[model samples]
Target: MHILILPSWYPNHANDIKGVFFRDQAQALAHYGHTIGVIALQRRSLRTLFPKKQNNKAPHFELDEGVPTYRCQVLEALPKIPYGNYFLYKRAAKTLLANYVEENGWPDLIHAHSTLFAGAVASEWGNENNIPVVITEHNSGFALNIYRPWQLKVADKATQGAQACIAVSPSLGEVLDQRLPSSKGRWEWIPNVVAERFNAPASKKYSAGPTRFLNLALMTEKKGQYDLLYGFSKLIGGGTKAELWLAGDGPIRAALQELANQLEVSSQVRFLGQVAPNQVPSLLQQVDAMVVSSHYETFGVVAAEALMAGLPVIATRCGGPECIVAEGDGLLVPPRDPQSLASAMDHIAKNLSEYSPHAIAERSKSRFSGAAVAAQLTYLYTRLLTSNSKVSQPKS
Candidate 1:
């Protein structure tokens, strides 16, 4: 099976941490014996804004972690141009497909990471070549609410044309269903996968701390970092003895740091900005629990990782986390409620033995392992390919 992935968020020289999950999936697919290739698209604007020293050396194609990647530049930079940037995405996808077909032969199926503009491009390419297209929608609640009318219309069109749709969680799939009901495609609920590397011995060794709580997301407004800090402050104020590890970097880092300072819990929270994907497991094993305060997540990959790390997770009643954190795995509080979040933290601190970090990690294997997810995805692609083959055959 020649599997081609069209991921809008892919790691590049400038943003090496971007879409590391998608890269993991691609690697898993390749390991499954599928002839996998990728057409990773980067916004031209982003590339120019952070021009790598290697930019002038031609578009050097390379194999990353065993997957063949063809990086194509999309925009000169994020365009402030007008109402919609549909043209930029379409042009990039068109160029990618053209180059892919010319150089590497046709792929059996194309799986797009987002239902944003990327789906439109995949639909166009699939239509042109009669190839099957599948889309995995990964968007926040805010984006879903703020999308323009035409954006929804384009998504509807693409959804209708797709062979199947995989939603990371039920809430996201429900939103997709409401937005585009006419699309005659099977919608499957596929959660994100965490790599085996994230699963480690809790007390075996190499953990950063003995009793730690971690927030492994970019520090941003939508991620609710400020709320997390406030909740942590409340927990500390209540005399809880736990260290907070804040991983990942974003625009809100300085502001969040200031908030921690104002709350006088700056020393308790360690900002370990941008840890590599491979290092996540060892880092997580050091922690006792993970906190996910994000208002929305298409799928909480870190929460799953924490579960895989055998650390209980304390997540908000946000769309994705509510679905992922089953009974006994963790607790969920209302989004943005510091009091409730703080209370949950206190409960965990007091009854640490109730939430077995090892049990939670074991439970995470079913939902977020690379091998499990890749098998499900491969099955979806194979089914679509076989169906397409039957349709194109001459009548018996």
Candidate 2:
């Protein structure tokens, strides 16, 4: 079956880590022998929209991760403008859909990732074009109470009209179900796909210098980087030979560094800003364990990735990590509690040899492998298409 994917967020040439999971999932589906077409809109400023002479605004088409993908650049500087989505993205989406249909024909399923505009676009356009639409929620915007009124309005319209709605974690599913009660009973909890590279760090050396703890989350307050620093400070207060790798960059990098300095853990924490997606596996393999210090998450992808790489995780009882970091695989402490997190860190550091990397990797693979995610997504698409066919047929 052919699948048309309308992603609300996608990795671009500039930001490879942004919504890259959706891209991976699309490739996974393509690997399953299904024809896939992705329409990823790059919301750019007015100046960036007008390139130095391109042929009729032809989409930058290329095969992304083995999936045929199209990047449609749209001007979205004035989000507060009237019908901003419709004018900037929705209209362009319709044109792209026409081009795609002309070349590849109508798809069996229109799967949208996230719901700011992709869900809305798929819902509106798919209905008009007589196609089944399914939306997978990835962001924690609604759960975090960060969504604007306009954003919520569009999100509701899209979800209400969708054949099915998916959330990356059970926690996120519950939050969405509450906000959109009418869309209940159609929610599925599917997680982000972990890359095939991450396997158990079975070759980890115990006496290889100071123990390294890897945290690859964005430097934000919500990510609890400060708490991690505080916890690390306490853990190493007794002169424990250890180092912290703070990966990923965000708005609060300066503040997090300052916090580390204030906590007197600055010397030990290495700030690795914005590591590429491809480099994560090696980092995981090198580290003794992974740390997820998020205050909340839809599904701690980093934690899952770490587990897949055969490294145990030290995660907070944040919204989603607790679900991924199972017993024996990792420790889950309360969010934002320095002393509790500090204690967990020290305990894990001391008992590093007790955790089985192979077991952790195997568990992660069972849940989040590309093939596994592909099977689940394909099943959902098939079910939706079958139901839609039944609904469309006249009563015999």
Candidate 3:
């Protein structure tokens, strides 16, 4: 099968982390022996004009890890115009798809990530060309209650037009069902794949040091870093010998640092800003456990990654972690509660022997590895294709 991916956002460069999961999924499908391609449309804001380096008006093509990728960058200069940015995205996507079809012929299926614009673009193109489309939504706007009316309308249309709609977690699926009841029957829960680099042997014994708990996420208000600091203070006050390590940086880093200082836990907390994706596995191995302090998540990816590396996790009942963390894997506490979070952390630190790293890794791999997710996606693709064949043929 030939599958083409359209992501609302994608890595502009090698180190870029935006919509990286879409790229990983495309690679996984390719590894499953299907021909895969990616067409990414990135819109740059006018604020970045001063730092402009090169002309990016033309589409850029490359064979990224054996999968063909086409990228087009556009400047968003008409923010005040209604749907101006979306119009630019549609134009670029249509042009890029035409070029891809000219080179490789029409794909057997179109898989779009997120509904904001990519899913809408793919839905429009598929409907016009008589192609099948599958949209996997990863946006948290619905859960966060931040989607504007126009955005919600676009999401509704895109989901209604797709052959299938997928959510990265059961909670996200439920949210989609509630928001777009018309597409409820088409919804499926599919998780993002954990990168293969996270593989590590299960630790037989805890690392010799102050029990280190790591939190890997952007230092944002929604990530609940402040609550994490307060919880860590409570844990320390309760006489637990532990260290807190925060990986990743964001706009609120200075504020979080200030909170740590005010709480006087700054000495026990370490901020390792913006840890690279390649460094995550080793970081997991170095730490005794991981903590996810987010108020909400579409999918708690870090928790899955930690479990894959044989490290236990203390995740909140935030939307996604409830699905990823199982019994014996770690404890799940209510979100935004410092006392609950502190208690859970303390419990994990004291009962490390009760959580088997080997068992956690085995279960996590079975659910989240590339091979595992690829198999599930292949099954979905085959089923959709077979059903489509019985219905009608594509228009030439």
Candidate 4:
């Protein structure tokens, strides 16, 4: 079926490293024989006063890896802008998308990623064009902290109107059901999938001296990088001989590094900023365990990938991590608690042999294989199209 996929974040030529998750899902849907068109929200747009700045990081409009994506730039220089403000972008994007679909034919349905922005867009477009929409909630609710007075009301209505809603983890689904209680739509559990490369053998080696812990999260406040550093320091003070390695980059990198230095654990904390996706498996192999301390997450892709690579994960019981990291696979700590994280780390370091890489990998595959995700998504799309088709028929 023809499908229009709208995502809040997507990888562009200028910033290919970001939004790799959205890119993977779009590609997988296309590969499964669905015609997919994308409208991604560009979170930043250069102001009219600074046209020169636009030249440096201009967004490119083209198809990347067979997914035709059109980006709608959002004005973000104004600091006080209300959160969940997608109407302007949606108006602009809908104009372009409507014209494209009119010249070509209308797609069967619109599939939106992330409830706040993409959900708003798909809701507006589907309502205007008399098409059905489906939303995949990727965040628990932290991203909605910036929403204005009426934004939540609008989101509630949009979610209620959708043909179906999907949550990447059970934790996210619980939040959605709680926030939008009026929405009686079918909510499905569809987690993200790991690529086949992650299941390959580990290419790197770890020394036998100290246990190495790896973190693969964006260096943002929600990721709780500072909390990780604080917890690691506490672990060191307890006489544990383990070094921490952090992967990924964000606005908080400098501050997190400073925090590490201040804690006198700079020697133990190594920040490997933004490794390529292909190089992730090798890094996972070299580490004894992976730690995820994000304050909120829709699904912890890195943690899942670590388990797929035959490595144990120690993640906070927040969002998707609570659902993905099970008893035999890894340890789950309370969110934003350094003491809890530290204790979990100490436990893993002491009993490292019990968490077998092969068993962890096998468990991860049961929940997050790419083929399974693709099939579930296809089912959702088909259901929406069939339901809408029947609704449009004349009464018998």
Candidate 5:
């Protein structure tokens, strides 16, 4: 089986961290003996200043993590186009597809990660070629109520034309059902793939200082970093000797840091911006626990990773974390509630010895591993293949 994955977010030279999970998933699916290729439509507008070194490159084609990938640049270096941009993107995608088909032939299936422009492009192409398209949505923007109307409209069309819709978590599926009723029946659940490297149970090391709680996210408002700050401050006020390490970089980093300063938790919080994906395991092993305070998540990949690291996660009642963080593995609190989050943080600080790292890692194997997810995805793709066969053949 051959698959062409169109991820809305994909790691690139400029943004190496973007959609790394999608690449991980592609590799995981490839592990099951399925040939996988990926492509992403990345547009550069005036808001982003491209590096001078990559100015000459166009139609960037390379093997991303051993999987053949093509990142076709849409309209770049253009002044205020003031448009939907998908029109330009779709045109570029169509042209890229022609080149892609000429080289690798038509893929057995086209899978889109997130229902933004990628799903839309795949849906349009699928309709034209009589191919089966599957969309696996992972963006939290929809559930967080920050997505635009145009984005939703495109996703809706993608869902309508899709053979199936997949959500990383049941909670995300529910959100999609509410937003697009047409896909309610077609929705399926498959979790994100976490590397086996992190599956080693952490040896919880107690340093001669504050207990460390690691929060790995984009540091955005939707991620509820402020809530984590307030919660950590509460723990500090309660005389809990613990510190919070805020990882990842985003637009909210400065504001979050300022908030931390204002809340007097600046001394207890360490802002570690943009840790590489490969380094997560070591960081998780060092930290006593993980905190995910996001308002919503399509799937809390980090929470799953934390479990893989044998670290208990204290996540919010956000969409995906509820599905990922099980009882005894971690604690769940109300989203955006600092009091609740602080209480949970303090509880973990005092009762750190109660959680078994090895048990956490062992239990997470079936649900979050790359191979585990690949098996489920393979079965789904096989069903889609069968469906395609039924459609291609005569009614007799």
Candidate 6:
């Protein structure tokens, strides 16, 4: 089967982490013996015009890690005009689709990531061409209630038109079903694939030190980093020997640092700003446990990565983490509750030896590895295709 993917945002460069899961999923499908291609459309603000980057008018094609990819950048010329950016996106997408079909022929199915724009575009094109469309929504906006009225309308149309719609977590699926009741029965949940590097055996042995707990995410209020800091401070006050390592950079870094100082836990908390994606697996090996304190998440991907690296997680009962952190895999606490978080951290520190790294990693592989996700996707694709064929057949 031939599958074409439309991702709302993609890595502009090799190290860009935006929408990387879409790329990984495309590669996984290709590895499963299905032909795969990607069309990534980037909408740049007018400010980028001053830098005078490479030509943005034309689309470019490349073989990205053996998967055919086409990328184009559209400058948002009329920001104040209603629906201006979306019109530009639709125009660029049509041209790219024409070029792709000319070179690679029509695909058996179109898989779109996110519903705001990509899913809308894919649904339009697929309907016109008589092709089945599958939309996998990875946006946190639905959970955050942040989408504009117009944006929600677009999402609804896309969801209603698609043959199938998927959410990255079950909790997210429930939210979409309630918000977009017309598409309720079509929604399904699937976990994202963990990178193979994370699945590799631990390369470094854990050295004896103060039990280190890692929190890897952008330093933001919604991420609940402040809550993590408060919890860590409480753990110290209770006479626990532990160090909190916070990774990733954001606009609130200085604010978080100030709070740590105010709480008098500055020395115990280390801010490792913006660790690269390739370094994450090794970092996981060095830490004793991982902590996710987000208020809400479409899917807590970092938690899955830590589990794949054989590290236990202490996650809040935020929407996504509740699905990932199973019994004995880790402990789940209520989100934004510093006392509960501190208690869970202390428990993990005391019973660190009880958590089996090998068993944790093995369980993660069965659910999140590339092969595992690919098989599930292939089954969905075949079923959709078979159903489409019967519906399109003429009366015998």
- Best of the candidates, TM-score: 3
Measured by TM-score, how close is model 5 to the native structure? 0.91
lDDT over C-alpha atoms for residue 224 of model 1: 91
List TM-scores for all candidates, in order.
0.89, 0.92, 0.95, 0.86, 0.91, 0.94
| lDDT values, one for every candidate | 0.78, 0.82, 0.87, 0.77, 0.82, 0.87
lDDT of 5 by residue, 1-396 (tens): 988888876777533667878878888888878889888777777555546566535347987567888877666453344325777877888887777777887888889987777888898788777678889988777777776666677778889988889999998888888887668767899888997767764455545568899999987788998888988888899899998999999999999989988998888889999988878888887788999998878788999999988888999988888888888997999999999988998888888888888888877888888889899888988898886753352111
| Candidate 6 TM-score, true structure as reference | 0.94
Off by over 4 Å in 6: 52-59, 200-206, 390-396
Among all windows of ten consecutive residues in candidate 2, which has the lowest summed lDDT? 387-396
| Clash count, predicted structure 5 | 0
Model 5: ten consecutive residues of lowest lDDT: 387-396
Query: What would you estimate as the lDDT of candidate 5?
Result: 0.82
Off by over 4 Å in 2: 45-59, 201-207, 390-396
Superposed by TM-score, candidate 5 places the C-alpha of residue 277 at a distance from the truth, in angstroms, of 1.3
Task: Kindly list the per-residue Cα lDDT of model 2 for residues 185-280, writing each as its tens digit.
Answer: 667888888867676555655447787898998787899988888888988996677899999899999988888888888889999888888888
Of 1 and 5, the candidate ahead on TM-score is 5
Q: Write the per-residue lDDT of candidate 6 for residues 1-396, one digit (tens) a residue.
A: 989999999877665667767877888888889999999998789988777567434338889888889998888897787677888998999899989888988888999999878999998888878888999988989988887777788889998889999999999998998777668877898888887879848443444777899999988899999899999999999999999999999989999999999999999999999887778888888789999999998889999989988888999888888878888789999999999889999998888888888889988989988899999999999999998862253221
lDDT (Cα, 0-100) at 171 in candidate 4: 71
Model 4: residues with Cα > 4 Å off, grouped in runs: 14-17, 45-60, 76-85, 102-104, 140-145, 184-186, 202-207, 276-278, 390-396
For model 3 the TM-score comes to 0.95
Better of 1 and 3 by TM-score: 3
For candidate 1, list the clashing residue pairs, or say none: 44-75, 44-76, 44-77, 45-75, 45-76, 45-77, 193-368, 194-368, 307-361, 310-357
Best by lDDT: 3
List the candidates ranked by TM-score, beginning with the highest. 3, 6, 2, 5, 1, 4
Candidate 4: residue 17 lDDT (0-100): 58
Q: Model 1's lDDT to the true fold?
A: 0.78
What are the C-alpha RMSDs, in order, of all predicted structures? 3.4, 3.4, 2.0, 3.5, 3.2, 2.9
**What digit string (tens of lDDT, one per residue) describes model 1 on residues 1-396?**
888888877878533667878887888788878988888877655535555565433253787766778886665443554424677778777887788777877777888888677777887678767788898888673235877776777778888778888888887777777767665345689887677777757564323333577899987898998888998899898887777889989999999989989999989999999987767777876678889998888788888878887888899987888877999987999999989889988887777777766677677887788888888988877788777753253211
Candidate 4, 41-64: lDDT as tens digits:
677644464565544353435666
